[model samples]
Target: MIFEMTTQVRVSNIEEGHKWYETLINKHPDFIPHKGFVEWELIPGCWLQVAEGELTEGNGPLRLGVTDIEGERERLIKELTIERFEIHSRPEVPVKWGTFRDPWGNRIGFFEYLDKKEEETQIKSILGTDSSRV
Candidate 1:
C-alpha cells in the first residue's frame, strides 16, 4: 500500500534553498505549498522536498539516474558553479556515478547506467517517456 513517496532535504534557509534547487533541477518546483517548503514530483508519485531547517550531516548522496552522467556533471559545474567531482565506477557496478554537495551541503549525485538498453527501459518506465528522450 505504500504507493507514493517523498524524500526531504533540509537547508538552513528557504530562499537560498529554493533558488539553488530550481537551478539544479532546471525548473520551478511542482508545488510550494507554504513558506520554507517546496516539492518536486520527480516522477509520477515520487517527490523530493526541500525544506528550511538545520542541515543534517552525513545525510545523503541521493543519486539520480541519468542517461549521461558526465554530461550532466559538466552542465552542473558550468551552470550551477558546482565544484568538479570525479565519476567513479567498477565492473561490479552497473553505472558510473559522481557526487557533490549542494550549497547547503546536501549530498547529491548523478549516475549513468552501463547498459544503454536497460537505462532506456528504466527511463521509459520511470518517466513514461520515449527512450530517446533519456
Candidate 2:
C-alpha cells in the first residue's frame, strides 16, 4: 500500500503566508499554490501539501527538501522580505540540513542532498529504510 501524508502548518497571517508561498513557487516552479495550500507532486497523482492555518505555541513548521540551499535562503530574505527567522541548531545527523522560522513563528527546515551517497543516507536516516522509498 502507498501511504502519503499531509502536513498542516499554522500561520499567524494567511496573507503573509500566501506571499511567502508565492516566493517559493516563483523559485521552484514545480510547486503549485492552491487556495491556502502549496503542493509538491513527487509522482503522478501523489503529492504533499503545505497548508496554512492557526498553530498553537511550540508547534513547528514543515521541513522541505531543496536542491539549492543558499539560493533559497537568499530569495526568502531578499525577495520575500521575511525577517525575524533563525537557523535552528541541528544535531549530528547524516543529512546536511538547516531550519528557519516563518513570519508566523513556524519552524521550517531546508535540506540539501549533497550527493547520491548523502541522499541515500538521508533516506535511510529519515524513513528508517535501507534504500530509497520515493
Candidate 3:
C-alpha cells in the first residue's frame, strides 16, 4: 500500500524557482535539504518539490483546493503577473476551477467548491480549523 507521495517540478534556475513558488504558496519552503532543491509538505506526508534541472511540459495543471478560487486567481495575477484565466464550472460539478502555469512552465491551478457546506467540511478537515474563519 502507498503510504506517502511526492511530486517534483523542474526549473532551470533554483533561486528564481524558489521565489516564484514562495509567492504562489505564500510561504518559504518547508524544507531545503540541500542546494538546488526544496520541499513543501503541502499536507502531512504529501510533498511538492521544486528542483533545479531540465524543465518539462505537460506535467501539470496540479490543481489545489481553495475556499475562493476567483479570489486566489485574482491574487495570483496581481502578485505574480500571471495571465488572467477563465474559471470554469458546471451545475452538476461541485467546484469551479482554473488552471495556469508557473514561471518554470509547470502547470498549476486552483479550485473552489461551489457548495459552502461542502467547502466548510473540506476546510475544517484539511486544515483542522473552523471553516467559518476560512
Which prediction has the highest lDDT against the true structure? 1
Highest TM-score against the true fold, candidate? 1
Error of 3 at 127 (Å): 2.9
What are the RMSD figures for all models against the true structure? 1.2, 6.0, 1.4
For model 1, how does the per-residue alpha-carbon lDDT over 1-134 read when each residue is reduced to its tens digit?
A: 89999999999989988998888888899999999999998778988999999789898888788778888888889988999999999999999999999988889999999999888888898878887755
Q: What TM-scores do the predictions have?
A: 0.94, 0.59, 0.92
* Per-residue lDDT of model 3, residues 1-134, tens digit only: 99788999999999999999888888889999999999988866788999999999899888888877888988988999999988999989988999999888899989988888888887788778886775
- Model 3: lDDT of residue 124: 86
lDDT of each: 0.89, 0.61, 0.88
**Candidate 3 positional error at 72, Å:** 1.0
The residue-by-residue lDDT of candidate 2 on 1-134, one tens digit each, is 85665545666665666567657556332465666665655333445455667665666546676666767777778876766344343465534666777666767777776576877766666656766454
Query: Which pairs of residues collide in candidate 2?
Result: none
Report residue 54 deviation for candidate 1 (angstroms): 1.6
lDDT of 3 at 121: 85
